[model samples]
Target chain A: MIATLLVVLQVVVATAITPLLIGVMRQVRARLEGRIGSGVLQPYRDVRKLLAKEPLRAEGSSIILVAAPLVLLVSSLLVVALVPLVTTANIPAVPNDLFVVVSILLIGTVALALLGLDAGTAFGGMGSSRHMMIAALVEPTVLMSVYALSIPVGSSTLSKIVVARGADVTRVVTPAGLLAVVALVVVVLAETGRLPVDNPSTHLELTMIHESMILESAGRDLAWLEVGSWLRLTALLGLVVNLALPWGLADSMQPLALLVAVVTLGVKLLVAGGVIAAAEVFMAKVRLFKVPELLAGSFVLAFLAVTASYLAG
Target chain B: MNPFRLLKLIARTGRIAEPAPAAPVADTEHPIPKALRGSVQVRHVDTGSCNGCEIEIGAAFGGVYDVERYGARLVASPRHADVLAVTGVVTHNMVEPLLRTVEATPRPRLVVAIGDCAHDCGLFAGAYGVAGPVSDFVDVDLEVPGCPPRPEAIVEALRRVTGR
Candidate 1:
């Protein structure tokens, strides 16, 4: 009963906080650029306003244009529920295996790429192709890095890995752990379309990888796409932080433990988001051709991490 | 530049945006839609301009003017926009594209005509290629009247829509 309740709480909390995370990141970027940003609550307003407007679809476009956003949103929510964020206590029926989690994320990624292609616009096709290329490179690194961490726990279930790491601090600070995390961070930036990989705020269609896909969608359709993408960032970033700092996660169903878990997760996510946004101020999006080089370099790091963990044990 | 130098420069530059002026009094003639009151995404359409209004529009969005602080953002697609910031006189060549762009935007949208050229064709009133003022081609909800309206004027017009 308590495990189910925790899963419910995880989904509800993650959904509520997703928009705030995007708002906070934008606020950080605006401040670093020496401008007073629209307040952190602005995303909530944008989403509400979008929901009130009529959605405009392109003539002759397939149902994928209408259905992809929901698919993406649902997949993101599933990932959030499966990942051990507020607690390491597992629900009996749901599998939180690393492979399962990665596959769920890919479902959303593919949905977005298809949404891009459904419109049949040049930019949409271009964006879809680029998005697929990046996803192709990003998935392996995500699997390998977690595989490296999984080696120490002798299990591929994410919640189990987190629980084991919380029990052993030495496992977290090892050379193998450090390399996997660095690789994970790079791939996370790439996966989430942050600066140095993709610029989330860019207006030029020529430079857009993510935005170009959804340019044909309007009103409520746009809102779903926006929120769905934001949720993916939230889920991935949440997983990254929990893996990096396994402390403060609730181990049981106690009320006090749940409260502490919620507070710590909020603080950790905000701090991580702000740090990433600030770091982005100093970096520019790499040219599309050079992106493979960056992703390849991270892959090498993950490969090294796996080798190191295997040899050390 | 190296990371160290960039860090020092950021610290030294500090805040460059001027203190924001008081919010504009709500325009009774053009009451903002309640839905768009807090946030408005603008898609700029250049019908045919001397490029003067384009530069000023750029300035309005730049760090110094920082119109985005009012929750008015420039978007890449009209489908993503709540307002069309139409600039310049409607030239013969641009009439169809402008109409298509406006048609592409979802309902509950506003068109804000920027510069005297967009309002009345300014000096381009009788030019060979000039079709008409923006209002002649589409319903202009707001007008910023200057040969090339100042950035502050452009910012003020957008603020009226965002109501922030």
Candidate 2:
């Protein structure tokens, strides 16, 4: 019963905060660029307006156009429910294993890739192929990095790993932990379509990875895609922050503990998002070809983290 | 540039956006719908302008004007747009593309004609290649009436659409 309550709380918290996180990031970027930004509530307003408009579908487009956004959104929600966020307690019958988490993440990735292809436009096809290539590279790094963290915990479950890390501060400061976290950070940025991998604010279709795919989507469809992607960012970034600073996560079903966990999770995600946006102002998106090199470098770091974890354990 | 230098420049050149003017009085004939009241994604279409209106449109979105503060953003595709910012006169070559772009936008959308050329084909009024004004091609919800509308005028027109 407590586990189910925690899952509900986690989903509610994540859903409420994801748009604000995107808003905060955009505001940070606008400030750094010396402009008066659209207020932090802008994303919520955009989503509301998008929902009220009619979604136009291209002629001959299949049901994939209608379905992909929901799949992406549902997969992200499932990952949020399963991953340790507000609490480390697992919901009965739901696997919070790292592999399960990664597989669920892949479902959203595939859904988005398919959405990109369903439009059949030249840019959509290009974006889909590029998205697939990046996903292929990113999934391995995500798995390897989390596997390294799972080593000392003696289980592949994400909650167990977070709990173990929380219990022993020394473990988090070790070479393996630091390397894996850094590698995870790079992959998170790449996975979330942030700068130095893919620029989220780009208007040029030719330079786009994610935006190009959704160029054909409008109104409610675009809103879902936008919110779905934002939720993915929220879940992944929450995971990264919780892993890096595992304090404040509720281990028991205490009301006060859950409250503290909610506040801390919100703060960590927003602060991390602001820092990322600020960091992006100084960096440019790498060329598409060079992206593989960057991902390959992170893969190497994850590989070393696994090796270091075994030696240290 | 060096990262430290960039940081210093950012600190030095903080907040260049001009203070937003008072919101325009709401239009009764084509008042912004409730859904688009707080946010509107604009997609600019340059049918066949001589580039004057384009320059002003750019300035409206740039740091000094910063129309985005009002929740109006320039998007990449017509599909993503809630507003079509159509500029220049419709030329024979551009008429079809302009019509298609407007058709591509989802319902509950507005089209704002951004210059005299888009309104009545200004200097290109009688050009052999010119098809007509933007209104001849698609429904224009609003108009900004300068030879090349000032950035302020362009921003004001959009603020009316966003009603921010």
Candidate 3:
């Protein structure tokens, strides 16, 4: 019974805090720019206002256009449910395996890109083309990074990776594991469309990728997209955080352990977000053609990680 | 990446000050906010202007002003807009399109005349091809009067509509 309760709590906490974490990054970016940013609760308010407003559909838009955001929202919810936020073993049905998690996410991305094409707008199609190019490169790197992290523990299960390393204070400091960390960081950055890859804040057509795809959607559809993006950000960051430093993840459902794990997970998620936001401030957006080289570089790191783990372990 | 270097740079140059608080909102002509409890999405229209109001509109979204903080944002389509923000004096050529855009917006729509030109045609009132104030077409819900109103005034108008 307690385990069931923790499972539900895990899902709710991760889902709810997703936007707050995004808000934190925005706030940090604003302060770094020496401006007074919106309050951390701004996402909450934005989502609330969006929910209250009526949605508008384009004249030629179809069921796909309408269903796209729903697909995005469902996948985001699935990801949060699958990711281990509190106890690593309380998952009731979703398998806690690396391959399963990555495959689920890939399906979600593919659906979103396909829906973009269904929007029937030229810009939407163009954004889909660009997004597909990036996703094609991102998938292999994400998988290889997972493989690298699992090498030392001799298991491919996501929870095992966490369980094996959670007690070790220095597992990630070694050369092979550090490569995994770097590779995953790059993958996460690319997946989330953060700076040096794609700028989330800009609407410049010549420079946009993700936001451009959803340009035709408005009102409630746009709101779902916005909230779904936040959930995706937190979900992916949660994976990276769990892999790189599984410290503080609870192995049992004791109330105190769950509480501590929840707090630790929140901190880890925010720190990762802050680091990404900081990277945004420190770097400029690379040109669109230059993105392949960036993804290629991450793939190289992922390759090296796999090579090193075998040689070093 | 050096924290000390960043601090040194910041200490040496204070952050850009907020654009002097928007020209004092002294006009009693600005409409009182309705009992709006939700956010507002604005679709900006430029019937005809010298580009002055657009510049200030940009400033209104810049870091310091951040109209988004008040639960209002600029969207790309009139279909998605809750408030149709018309700028400058409408040209005869623009009158039909302006009305159509406002009509395209969903119900519970609002009309905000963005500047003096939009308010009562401003300096362009007698210009050829001018269609006079936006009121000459659709009913305006709010009026922000300035050749180029400050970002704060624009934000204030939005706040009144959003009840922020």
My TM-score estimates for the predictions, one after another, are 0.99, 0.99, 0.90
lDDT of 3 by residue, A46-152 (tens): 67766655676767778977888888888877777777766677455667677787777777687678767876778778878888899899989988988887899
| Winner on DockQ (2 vs 3) | 2
Q: Mind giving the per-residue lDDT tens digits that candidate 2 earns over B1-164? A: 79999999999998899998999999797667788888999999999988999999999999999999999999999999989999899999998899899899998989999899999989889999999998887888899999888999999999988888
Model 3 DockQ (Cα-based):
0.35
Residue B129 CA displacement from its true place in model 1, Å: 0.5
State the lDDT at A98 in candidate 1. 95
What tier of docking accuracy does candidate 3 attain? acceptable
The TM-score obtained for chain B by all candidates, in the order given, is 0.98, 0.97, 0.80
For model 2 the local lDDT of residue A245 reads 96
Q: Please say which candidate is ahead in lDDT: 2 or 3.
A: 2
**Candidate 2 wrong stretches, greater than 4 Å:** none
lDDT of 2 at B48: 91
TM-score of 3: 0.90
Question: Whose lDDT is greatest here?
Answer: 2
Candidate lDDT scores, in order, read 0.91, 0.93, 0.78
- Cα lDDT tens digits, model 2, A1-313, are 8788888888999999999999999999999999999999999999999999999999999999999999998999999998888889888698799999999999999999999999899999999999999999999999999999999999999999999999999998999999999999999999989989999998999999999999999888999999999999998999999999999998777889989999999999999999999999999999999999999999999999999999998
Q: Largest DockQ belongs to which candidate?
A: 2
The C-alpha stretches of model 3 lying farther than 4 A from their native spots are A1-4, A90-92, B1-8, B14-39, B64-71, B75-81, B96-109
What is the TM-score (0 to 1) of candidate 1? 0.99
Q: Count the backbone clashes (under 3 Å) in each candidate.
A: 0, 0, 0
